[model samples]
Target: MIDLARQQLAHDADPLVVKVGTRCLTLPDGTLDECQVESIAEQLVRIGAGTTRRVVLVSSGAVGAGIGLLKLPERPTDLPSLQAAAAVGQCHLMESYNRAFQEHGLLAAQVLLTADDINDRRRYLNFRNAIRALFEYGAIPIVNENDTVRTAELSRTVGDNDQLAAMVTNALRAPLLVILTDVDGLYDGDPADESSQVIGMVEAIDESTTGFAVVGTHKSGPVLSKGGMLSKLQAASIATHAGESVILANGRSPNILVDLMAGEPLGTLIPGQGGRLAERKRWIGSAAMPIGALTLDAGAVEAVAERGKSLLPIGIKAITGIFDKGDLVSLIDEAGVEIARGLTNYDSSDLGKIMGQPSEAIADILGRAPYSVAVHRNDLALVRDAEGS
Candidate 1:
């Protein structure tokens, strides 16, 4: 048996973000399973009842639940159809959550977000404030992508709710992210292949195993099922890198949420980097989507990764794509591996002229210097290995 008390204490001492996937919350027949939803809700309420630690739920199933309610045979293939289903399903989904939480004497608030919402500066802060208010008011905020009005450019974009949950965890400055999926945890290979084994822990998320394929249930497709195990791994990497621990566990078992909060060793635990990033940097690192790429020399890579220095023009080897000043861009090594992401103070056109120049030379070349470094250290997030360390 898992040590429930210890685990719960650990989770309580740390910031915890719980993400419930569609497969776990839905039945085998691709229908919203009320029993499981109620069970999970009860467990969450129990966990949050007396704890000072905040709990935010990033849930999937707006479309799946909608499908069940609309009696659709399969998930829609087109954008409009999917959006329509999501529109109808989001209401039913929230209703189910509200009803379930009420049974536990809790009130649940609905928060719908698009990728663009967090990707923008003003909107991100607004969304964060709204969620914080909900928590302060003693309500559990159930978040999902706003698919109804989201365009392909904005809405159909986030890899999955798993990724969104990670972003939310970072945005909220949570200490831990608990991802409850249908599978037991991450495995070295396919779990049903008879020879695959669950990887008990991950220290770093690297390239060799980063793209593991995610198998899906009848209700979801391999890629569409909340980004599969691979996306969850990526999400874990993001969260853990920002100094937050993550857990990927099976949600099918009875009382699993309660068990996890109780501190039971029921799933794979991804340890976090020891110290937390400052709040502003955390948002820039996790929420800012890179609009372009900046290829760097070996020295620049070392400076940023090891010495924690700002990215200077002297280190830039080449530039790719067009990004405006203040846009988020990726810093890549010579091998085209992304080392980190940061907001640039110069536009692509300006960077092209100032590449490989000293900070002092910026004013000379452009007639006026904006700031010294192209990407400041305070605006960067280093990419972790395939297994989150």
Candidate 2:
């Protein structure tokens, strides 16, 4: 069935973010597949043809290409060796993309970014401006993580191409984000079983949806990709919660991009929220990493998560990690699940003294009542509800 959301995206999605996994562009031997790269370039061009819509491509396979180029027996495990492979493979990957896009009379602009780049507000906006400039120049922006400098940034726990692509989609306010992988969207059962079928659309990401993410992976073994379906789903959750759509589809299929944009129901379609989040809130919820965490009592959790109230010291029961004033910290419920994140008004040391104390007792505990609230409602962003964790 054709969803109205997909149709709307086909007609109105101005700048699209498409993420292609490493496994889709590499062989079992970890070599760069030129033919696949060319096909991807061609499909990207076709998606923009006869329209003003532009595309930003998030591509993987640097380490794989490096392994093939250096003739390594297997994928590297150490940080130095992985970085070395990335340094070599980034050049080869760009060369292939440049040549492939040139065939269609389009310029491919390579943009390498690091986690710190996306984490800082100033650097993040600068990255967005650079992409906009490339659009004006009529060039397609091909983005990848700067693995050569900080391969740790690509670790699944910290972040990956999938998370990077979602961040780009939010930063650009792109209406759609299409994640292309090896498997055929998300499945109801094990993908290896013939009886399992692809789920057509997902309105919201919940525990049930996340349960499906544990089916492991297809096509890409551990040597090729560290990100599995869970990472992709988490990425999708990030985008969708920000009022942007996501399509998880198989890149190996012929003309997959073309078919998906045409509202052909090619993959699992996760629809967007009703309204977009404010820029500052978006950053707090998705971009910024927390330095510390505060565990709130049940009453505090209800007040903050359900009533849109500020976090008070009276509700805070436990604190973890060392952080200072204005630093980002996570708010955890009694169950240890993160309910929200925001900038704290006081440093960890100050907070430790006043936790569980009423607002009136702040001055007595800290010697100065500069502020009453632990986290202002204006600064806090509710995450658990949107992510449905």
Candidate 3:
């Protein structure tokens, strides 16, 4: 049984996002380690089984798994070659997950997303709704960044699964974000040197530990298997500020997920602010990529941040970049600080006409009111201070 305080903390926690790293899923030789993957899946099944808790897995190792299956010498550096490996590996990765989950009588659903999928408001809503439906059906959603289609040039790059998991946690409003890697947890110094100690229970991630070694081998001077420990910290910071907790642990440990859920001391824990973001508001704040930004006057900023009111067009003193209706955009104050992010119902063109206009005059100015609130409260996510900076 979990401690009452811990249980309440977990229950009232933000959404949980678990990112499975390549090193955790693959052997040192870069092969799919079925035993390890299966073990991790079983643990997850135990945590989500017969509970209201929802789990969103952000996984890597498609390329590595594929390379092993295809007998490739190493991870390809070229985009086309990398895409080819991802194409083959994504299938194998899903198959392994499906087989493992079946042993626990759980079904796994593959949900591949690219940066573009989350950048477009329509697609973002569609993706979110689909994943929600999958959970409702008692199936585990296996999420991966769509590597086969993603390009370096894409405007909406998640960069690594760590960042992706953070975004997913925000999207699902998960109470926790678990990052399972090869290492035990974040360390105070280089654990490889045997002089370092594991840093447990981080209230916040900060510069004191920013230079710690991430758990992975690099071909080119610490390129990081994908996003590395730095990225994980960055993601954790985002999730925690959104009122979600985060944990970084080793996936190889037996019953890891179950133990963590039960508040066992197994890894580093980053606590969350004990509050929940409203559903629609969470979606607006987290979903989609911000294509543009709205600069507000000081008064407007105060009203939105302190008064908890919807953003009106009158507050918008200036706009930057071109954006379509329903696009995710950033709300910046006079200092160019991102106060919030949300889905805009009106396009930049429409907004230009309505800027400084009253909400009541929206219909008269545009022939019809797209929405009463320029950026509805439900569609906004307030920014918090950076964690582990």
Candidate 4:
């Protein structure tokens, strides 16, 4: 179904977040494509020329560019090799973007981020302020993961550009997140098959919607990157859950950004699901990476999920991983589904001692109870609702 209202929401959205994948930024041989970069930069400049809407571009191609420069047979699998490639290619990547945007009479600001940037609350706010300042100066902010420093291949926090883009969208509260990839859109069947049809609109991203991602799993993206349709869908889920719309379309398509702004149904649209979350809650749900998990009992699950109660020590049945006090932790139900995430009052060792014990028993068990509750309701962010769970 084509809904003009939703399309209008995307069309009129200020501060649009656009994510361009490696396939769009790199040639088939994994070389950085300067012409493609220019074309994309031109389109962005055209879209932001007259409108007050601020455009932020999240790009992926450093490793691919390195591969081409090094004339590697394929993408490197080792962490050291990947890091070395990123270091070598990051300079080239920024140079291309700067050259491309400068031709359109615009300056491009390079922002490299890692998981620590999002995990730390102060740094997260700092990043937001920096982006705002860049917009004020009439410069386009181009963001990418700090692959040279981050071991994303080993542990995924700023996993890929897709996830990084989603986090940025949530952090900025951008109304629309446009993801540009190689595919036309999410298909109902195998993308390579002629019978597969591109879905026009998605109201929400659920298990059924994500199922479409696996339909054509065999035909993944080029060897330049590890991201695929599933990653894009995960990105969509993040943005949509934060009350932001997403448009996944092919970047190679002609006049795609301009046409999208004109309210043409050119891509698969996943509209925002509910009201936008507050800044703190958005950070908790979308940005904070859980260092540990607390498994809740049946009663605790019902109380937290339905009654909106805080997580008490008595509710916790098990704890996994070593984490310190004030660290972000996941709250999972009996079925191992994550219900919420919040800052914990006690460390993993202390929580282990106080598990299934009442608030009165914490002081007795741990010498002193710093906080009565394990995780206060104010600090907790529910990822799934009761019905959804």
For all predicted structures, in order, the TM-scores are 0.90, 0.94, 0.81, 0.96
TM-score leaderboard ranking: 4, 2, 1, 3
Quality of model 1 by C-alpha lDDT: 0.79
Candidate 2, which segments miss by more than 4 Å at Cα? Answer: 1-4, 151-158, 219-222
* C-alpha lDDT of residue 10 in model 4: 58
Model 3 error, position 297 (Å): 4.5
Clash numbers, per candidate: 17, 0, 16, 0
Q: Candidate 2 — what's its lDDT?
A: 0.88
Top candidate when judged by lDDT against the true structure: 2
lDDT of 4 at 355: 93
RMSD of each: 2.8, 2.1, 4.2, 1.9
Which residue ranges in model 1 land beyond 4 Å of their true spot? 3-9, 154-156, 207-226, 384-389
Candidate 2 residue-wise lDDT, 316-353, digit = tens: 99999998898889999988999999999999999999
Q: Across residues 125-236, which tens digit of lDDT does each residue of candidate 1 receive?
A: 9999998898788788999988887777542266678989988988888877889988878777676766766666676666544644354222234222435777788888
Provide the overall lDDT of each model, using Cα atoms, as 2-decimal numbers.
0.79, 0.88, 0.78, 0.87
Residue 81 C-alpha lDDT in model 1? 80
Error of 3 at 305 (Å): 2.7
Worst 10 residues of 4 by lDDT: 380-389
